[model samples]
Target: MIEIRNLKKSFDDNEVLRGVDITIHDGETVAIIGESGCGKSVLLKHIIGLLQPDSGTVKVDGILIADAKEDVLYALRRRIGFLFQSAALFDSMTVYENIVLGLWEAGERDEVKLRQIATEKLGLVGLGARSLLDFKPSSLSGGMKKRVGLARALAMQPQYMFYDEPTTGLDPVTSDQIDYLILSLTESFSTTSLIITHDLFTVKRIAKRVIYLNKGLIFFDGTPKELEQSTDKTVVQFIERFVK
Candidate 1:
């Protein structure tokens, strides 16, 4: 479970998050939506302990992120997987190495075991062939890179999966594929999934709940149907003026 209470953050003179409150239960798939500079990123950072909130608290599965010790925080992070917007794979690493990088860092030395783990995760993301594991990120297409990134995240066997703009750069078909993968993975793993995206289609397709942030606060919190059918002018305008 993820919980936030009165989460407030500010940068210099700007208040990015103002008294935000949210609770995500275990095994839930949720989407957070907002325009640029709406504090969506700040909120996500707080949840994962990337930034300390000026006030309030962020707790992941009962561990208070703001006050956890270094070792505790490190362990907490091990249970959470973040799929960054750019895939963020190291340029110097091969697909196989990238997938097992976390495991190696955590002191896993068995090469055969690492290979087995990588193979299973890659298959989960629809990249079943073992030969592709030898290829570098540079040789893979955009969608393939995203799938590889997803595979790497899954290698941790995380209880929570967070995706940042999972389909921003893909073509329509590829975007749909990513969306389906996300939905399928959520059900297959029963991982608590939280997605930060601007794509309405993604929200409609996968999210069990939608939270809309506006001007440093949550403007709406409900199901995707309620968000789409909202009569509020702010929600309507955001949807109409999306892609900013």
Candidate 2:
């Protein structure tokens, strides 16, 4: 579980997040939604220790993420996974190499174990055998790259997963596929996930709960049905815009 309390952050003279509070339970899928520049990504970064909050605390399980030492943060990071908006895969690395990079970098050289984990992760994302594993990121489609990124994140068998704009530039079909993959992965791994996205459909399909942020504040926090039935003008407008 993760708890964010009175989280605040500022850049120069502008505040990005203001007194935001959120809690994610173990094995739950929570989606963070809001208009652009509402600090959704910043919030995710803070939770993962990629950014520091000027004021407030991000607690993972029982430990305060903001107060943790560098070594402690590093160790904590290994138990979490992050999938960037851009897929964030190295063009130079093959699919297999990308999937297993973290384990190898952590000096996990048990060839048998490495192969076992890599194969299982790739299979989970619908990737074929080790034959295509040697292919570079450039050789794959956008959706395939996204799947590869997911495979890489799963390689660590993280207890918590964070996704930043997972469906961002993809077509509707592709987005739906990715959402299905997310749902499948969540059930298979029983991992808690924090998905930062503005896609309403994605939120409805994958989020067990949704947190709506506006101007750094949590404007609404509830289930999809609650959000859709919300009378709040902001929530209404937000949902209306995404309605096909």
Candidate 3:
């Protein structure tokens, strides 16, 4: 489980997060939604130990990551898979090399085993064809790049998955494909998934629980049905603008 209490963060004169509290149970898929600059990405960074909170506690499975030792933090991080917004693949590397990079970083050195893992994960993400593995990021389309990124993340077989704007630049058809892939993978691995997105369609399709952050605070937290039925003006307006 992930527990965050009284989380706060600031950048020089700007206070981004203000005493935010949230708990994500195991094997659950949660979506965090908010307008740009509402601190959604900042909160995600804090959870993964990329950013230290000014004053708060972030615990992953009872281990306090806020101030853990480097080794401890690294160990915990290995169990978490982060799919960055831009896919973050190395442009110089081939698709197979990119997928196996995660395993190599985790200290795996056997060539056959690494290739096997990469092949399996790529298959899981619908990039099973052996020929595509040799292609670089430049040759793949946006949706294919996203799939390859996801395949890399899955190579870790992480217990927790974090997606940052998983469908930000895709067309509607590709966005729906990504959404379905996320939902299928979560169930396939029984992984705890947390997605940060502005696309309400993705939220409605995959989120079991929706969290709406506004002005650095959790403005609403409930099921998708409750979010639609909410009476708050901010909530209603956000839904009307994004839900289509």
Candidate 4:
């Protein structure tokens, strides 16, 4: 389980998060939604130990990551997968090479085993074509790059997956496909998913629970249905902007 309590952060007097508290149970898919600059990405960084809270506690399975030792944090991070907004792929590397990079970083050295793992993960994301394996990120389309990034994340077989704007630049059709893939993979792997997105369609299709962060605080927390039906002006206004 992930537990966050009284989380707070500031950068040179700009307070981004204020007394935020949230809990995500195991095997649950939760979506975080807010306008840009509401500190959604900052909160995600804190959860993965990329950023330390000024004053608060973040615990993953009872291990306090806020101030854990390097080795401890490293070990804990291996169980988490992150898909950056831009896919963050190495343009110089082939698709297969990129997929196996995670396994190699985790200390796997057997080339044959690495290839097998990459193949399996690529298949999971529907990018298993032999011809595509040799292609580089520079040669793939935006949606294809996203799929490759997801395949690479899955290469680690992480228990937790974090997606930052998973469908930000894709067309509606591709966005829905990515949403379906996320839903299918989470159920198949029984992994906990934390998604940060502005797309209400993706939220409705992928999120079991929705969290609205406004001005650094959780303005609303409930199911997607509740969010749509909410009478709270802030929630209703936010939804109306994208839902119509």
Candidate 5:
């Protein structure tokens, strides 16, 4: 389980997250939504221990993230997969290399095992062709890059997957495809998923629960249906903008 309590953080003069509390149980998919700069990404960083809060705590399975030693933190992070907004792929590396890079760095030197890991993960994301494994990120489309990133993340067999703007730049069709992939993979792996997105469609399709952050606090926390049906002004206004 991931537990966050009264988390607070500030950068210089800007206070981002304020007294935020959220508890995500195992095997759940939670979507975080809000305007840009409303602290959604900031909170994600806190959860993954990339950013330490000035106050409060973020605990993963009872381990305090802020207090963990470097190795302890690394171990925790190894169990979590993150897909950055830009996909963050190394343009120079081939698809196969990208997928097995982590395992290789961790001391898996057998080429056969590395190839097997790469092939299996790529198949999970529907990129199973042996030929494409030689293609670099620079040669792939945006959606393809995201899939490769997802494939790489899955190579770790993470217990938790964090997706940052998973469908940000894609067309509606591709966006829905990505959402389907996320849903399928989450169910397949039974992994906890935390997605940060401004897309309401994705929230509806991917989230079992929706968290709306506003002014450094969670304005609403409930099912996606609840979020859409909410009568709150802020909720209505936000939805209206997306609905149009």
Candidate 6:
């Protein structure tokens, strides 16, 4: 389980997350939705140790993350996989190489085992052995790169997956396909997911629970059914705009 207590952060003067408190249980797909600059991404970064909160605590599976020791932080990171907004694959490496890079960087130099696992990860994302393993990230289409990114994230068999705006730049059909892939993979692997998105369709399709943030506060936290029936004007508007 992941828990945030009284989390707060600011950039010099502008506060982003204001005394935020939330808890996400295992095997749950929780979507965090808010307007731009609402600090949704900031929350995800805190969970991953990319950003530290000015005050409060972030605990993952009983480990304190906000201010963990370096070794502890590294250990925590190994258990989580992050898919960035841009896919973040290396331009010079082949798709297979990209997937294996994390393992290599972690000091796993057993080529035979790495290759086997990388191949399995590729297949998990609906890619075949014949998929261009030698082609660099620059050679792949947008959707293909996204798939490769997903495969890389899965290579570690992370207990948690963090997706930042998974559907931002895609067409409707492609976005839905990505959403389905995320939903299917999370269910099949039983991995906890924290998705930060403004996409309501993606939220309705994949989120088991939803958190609506406004002006740096959690306006609502509940199941999708509850979200759809919320009565607050802001919450109601968000639901109508996205969940409908």
What is the Cα-based lDDT of residue 119 in candidate 2? 80
- Tens-place lDDT per residue, model 2, 83-145, is 999899999888888999889988999878887787888888888554567788998888888
CA-lDDT, candidates in order: 0.92, 0.90, 0.91, 0.92, 0.91, 0.88
- The TM-score of candidate 4 is 0.96
lDDT (tens digit, per residue) of candidate 1 on 107-207: 99999999999999899988996578889899999999999999999999999999998998999999999999999999989999999998999998999
TM-score of each: 0.95, 0.95, 0.96, 0.96, 0.96, 0.94
Instruction: Report the lDDT tens digits of candidate 5 across residue range 1-244.
Output: 9999999999999999989999999999999999999999899898889999999999998999999999998889889999988899988899989988888877889999898888888888877764578898999999989999999899888999999999999988989889999999998889999999999999988899999999999899999999888889989999887666
Looking at model 2, report the run of 10 residues with the lowest lDDT sum. Answer: 125-134
lDDT of 3 at 80: 92
Note each model's CA RMSD in angstroms: 2.0, 1.4, 1.2, 1.2, 1.2, 1.5
lDDT of 6 by residue, 1-244 (tens): 9999999999989999898999999999999999889999999999978998899999999989966899999888988988888999988889889998889989999989998888888887777655667789998878778888988999988999999898888888889889999999988989999999988888889999999888888888998778888788988776675654
| Cα error of candidate 6 at position 237, Å | 2.3
Overall local distance difference test of candidate 5: 0.91
Error of 1 at 111 (Å): 0.8
Clashing pairs in 5: none
lDDT tens per residue, model 4, 195-233: 999889989998999999999999999999999999898
Runs with alpha carbons beyond 4 Å of true place in candidate 6: none
lDDT of model 3, residue 209: 99
Pairs in steric clash, model 3: none
